[model samples]
Target: MSRLFLALFLFLLIREKYGYTNITLTVNYEKILAEVRKEFLSVSLDTHLIQLNWGGLNFENQRVQRYARNLAPAILRVGGTSADSLYFKPAFGKELASKNILPCYDPCNCDMDYKTVETFNMTARQWHQLANFAQRVGWTLLFDLNVLDRHNGSWTGKNAELLFDYASRKSVGPVYWQLGNEPNILPHFYNRSINPSTLGRDFLKLSTIVKKYKAFQQSLIVGPDVTHPKQDMNSSKPMKYLRAFLQAGGEALDAVSWHHYYFDGRQATADDFVNITHFDSFKEQAKLVCSETRRILGQKKSVWLTETSDGYGGGVRNLSQTFIANFLWLDKLGVSAQQGIELIVRQSFYHGCYGLLNPNLEPTPVYWLSVLHKRLVGTQVFNVSHNSGSKIRFYSHCGNRKSSLVVFGMNLNNFSVGVNFGKELAKVKFRVFIWTEDLVIKGFKDIQNKFVKDISFEMPPKSIAFVKFRKLVGVQACK
Candidate 1:
């Protein structure tokens, strides 16, 4: 017995030195912190400023709607760069107005007058169609109102009021409103800037319009909707903008909103997706936002990441669309929820380089990962810790239905590693599901009953595993 104990200790010592030991994952089921909100995972769409009719056309497609419905009970945000300059046509059935169609050398800035700015028109029929689709898919519409119209720095509320009036008459599914997209960075793209006080005043004006309508009275008003923070002084910093906006219009906001991207798409790589440090940095940034929100709004308001993908600028062509993106996607879900973010709106559902569904309306690897996350992980988030290296990242949540606890692990290393659940859980039966290279999904049966303390399995390189335990002994949180 003494010799056996010595040998086991030496084996563990050598494995630890070489970083080959089984990762001991500890889940404290009793330590439930937050109830993950049902709408925590949502999606957004680019409206192309209502021009090109991208928003109206995409949701109407049967295949697109069907794929979206799979992730039901989500928030569908319709806005992007185009939202900042979107124009409205209030006259019902009026012929669509034509733009000057300037041929500017710079794609970012196409200088034009107010008449040309109203490039896209959302007819009454299209509005009704979008509303009906939202209702059918069990999603709420988060419509972005243009703040940069001819009204100057302030929102005139004419087009917004018209939209609300139409929505109320049609009884659209609970429509929430965001003032604009990436307001902090507007100067860089549109050569226009609105001070926080001006934005606050505009929000108040919109709120007054909303209160006049019966259907919109209870609708949420979320904003600032700024881009992520930047280190450079020349770039826009969302936190600084958020502080100013909250001070000026803090009373008007229902939720604080912002966007995040891991890196620039031009330089992004698959290795970046699996790097644990990259996710750690993201968590720190989220923490900073959380701290700022508490300082400004106390506990009354919640923070939301309204637009985020693996990389900005449409995301990397191959990395963002392939199976490796799941590592970043899943990690974002787990870490964001843990950091107290109320919701995470993925940059897009479709119609972008980083879309979860391809142009053919087929599910991408990220979409499959999302389906598994929604179906397996429940509302309650449990505490999970790891004793191994950074290559293995672990998260725990209460199971969806029959299962008691769901454990998710991401293997970032190039080699397989074993995962041990400790002796207390050795006898328990677990169902395992894996997503790896080429978007392949595989499942394995229960671990053999003979194992006393740990279970050894080869978690392939750059893979993720979802392990569900049948029952937990005394987890009141699961109940």
Candidate 2:
């Protein structure tokens, strides 16, 4: 009896050990979790650029246009904390002039010297340049209006009407609109506090203004952009604010939007980027937002991660700008899709530490990942289940090719993990791409031209992998 017991214990231990090393992934192709927007992954530009007069952007630069084109079929969001203070000089009334302005020396001398930090000005010329640039880049423009402009504690929206009137006259085309930027955190940054109910009424007024313009008739309105739910005195708790906003004027919004960052940029460590617990936190936050939105507004209105990154304060210095950041970015895309987020606008295209490209317009690891995602993955997502638990994070999607499917995931383990596809993907030919921890890409070759009975591969530790089955047998969903 003792010998038999010892043998059973050894067998069980061996099974457990091998099971963890070899992850088995199965996808339910028929069960589509969600269909992401065609412009699912978008990018944003901080209005701070215009407020600070940081040379704005050399929209004429070939390199800049080239990189921007790569992220085409996206929404170019013009918003940030500075957006709340932005004033359209074309429509600046005498009443707005009474507010104290934060002055600065303009480096470009774009005639922006007269503005203050509390009241930065955007000229008509700058507006046309930005609108033209968005048109030229084949991107949809989502502009955020100044919500802090008030008269007797009510949003006047006179400036927003003037800006929209100018755009309509110029035929600037359709523009998605938002009322503010991170309204929950306004008290901390701007010493201004507007409750959610008041903000909702403000949104209703803004919606009325937007409808007045012929050019914006078909445009979408999204808002009450807030950060993750946090119980801090500096900001309104995001969930509470959102509920109040929706309750007051939920019908005014076309979509619900929010922002997220896994860690604070100033205090992030390299290890924090790859922490599994941190990823779980992100998932939980997303789930909470989705559930709350559905409960309040129902499924009619979609949710958006309009502004997000690795860390909030301009991103982490070395960690966010490195290849390690792909773990979070990739995981974010996968999780966002699963949670029914229609759109995720990455913070910036070219301005900060979190920018996909450096000042020189060179690609980062996340940029390449975006490229691969755009070229290979489709809108329809398949439900993927893996036996290796959280050690291997996996997502499956219908590929861009005819009768094809793609399985992409990250291996968070410090040691390489092996992947074994289910029988449904057996006898399939695939090409693989693996981005390693050292920022080098490996494994781009096709396994074989002929069908393989069983497909298996090693995922390098702390790396991302994409396996595309050129012709996934018996998968009718891709059709």
Candidate 3:
């Protein structure tokens, strides 16, 4: 049988396999809460990966290209902690070294003794390969520039200018730029700190450099990509740092960016993935970031969650790679869109345990969810409210199709919760997507897809579902 037929067969096979209940909830789609960019869903490539020879990406592999294309028109961000130390070489040869800095072989092994600067190098050939791969896959490139390459506590921009000149000469045009990665925590990693004022100055200098190159003239400059904005002992308060950065370099920036992670991989548990409180924490952080951006930079600049994932420290092995992690991943997309974030870049698209695809290019559950989201969810966000309590999250967005809306959510409760989309959607057809508990092992074989005519249905506990309301009469926002 064909693949489509097989998918359809499996979808039908599990239609009535799970039980149902009468937990009716409501959806309010009259207002558009926020709108996101057409290219809202994006992925990030860790610099360590490129330093580690593509980190097993194998862009030459058809499967790799195919999987990547599934989420096309995305922003492929080449950044991470290693971005601060990576430099572009003019040619392919022995890697350059400076400040007694050794070329980074292992991206994860960080030296706690930060008396001297550590560095990594990539050749011009590798740079072109990266651009070629992104072009082939129809992704926009967002390159993060090195911030630690400074002289007299000021950004030199010499290395960045060389890279720009190379990209321009090589005909790689129109890549987005970020000056640094988490400058608030710089003191911890490099035993150095670029105060927000200095960071702002650095960004301004980077902007001037960007404008000099014809190829990078129109590129969007986004930064100061800091961590979550909260008071913490380990790093500068991101909120205060962000405010200072914007005050100093707001004129140079086109957008605001930040990173977020729900749990520390070293200390996270499987149960944390499904915790409603953790999801709420992300919602709160997103709100604060959005509000801060608007307060400082005004309403014109967009906010981006440039780097985010479930577990920050290389991700928790089995938990991050398994089916349970979708709870946090799916909710993040929902909350970010609702809170007016224009783009979200998932970190290490193919590097660590949190990768959407493993090194061999085999997809994790979240990869499939991302595919579904890109294919089904549209840029128009609708204001959706429900009385389903904390365990159930409901978000509505204009469907990819005209006059259609897709309402998606995950049931955190161990028992099924019935949902009612209200009388407004009483006659619409529902397409339910719920996978079996063995999703990580069986892949799509465990996915259940069926069209239901009923206005209400029960979603199995700990399961995520996407219901597309087709044949809708009126949803002004969708149109």
Best by TM-score: 3
Using lDDT as the measure, which candidate wins? 3
TM-scores for every candidate against the unseen true structure: 0.86, 0.87, 0.89
lDDT comparison, 1 vs 3, better candidate: 3
- Model 1, TM vs. native: 0.86
Task: Compute the lDDT of residue 457 as modeled in candidate 1.
Answer: 54
Clashing pairs in 1: none
Taking the tens digit of each residue's C-alpha lDDT, what string does model 3 give over 249-288?
Answer: 9888888999998877767888899877899999998999
- lDDT per residue for candidate 2 within 440-473, as digits (tens), equals 5321122122223336777777778888887655
Q: Candidate 1 clash total?
A: 0
User: Comparing 1 and 2 by lDDT, which wins?
Assistant: 2
Weakest ten-residue segment in model 3 by summed lDDT: 103-112
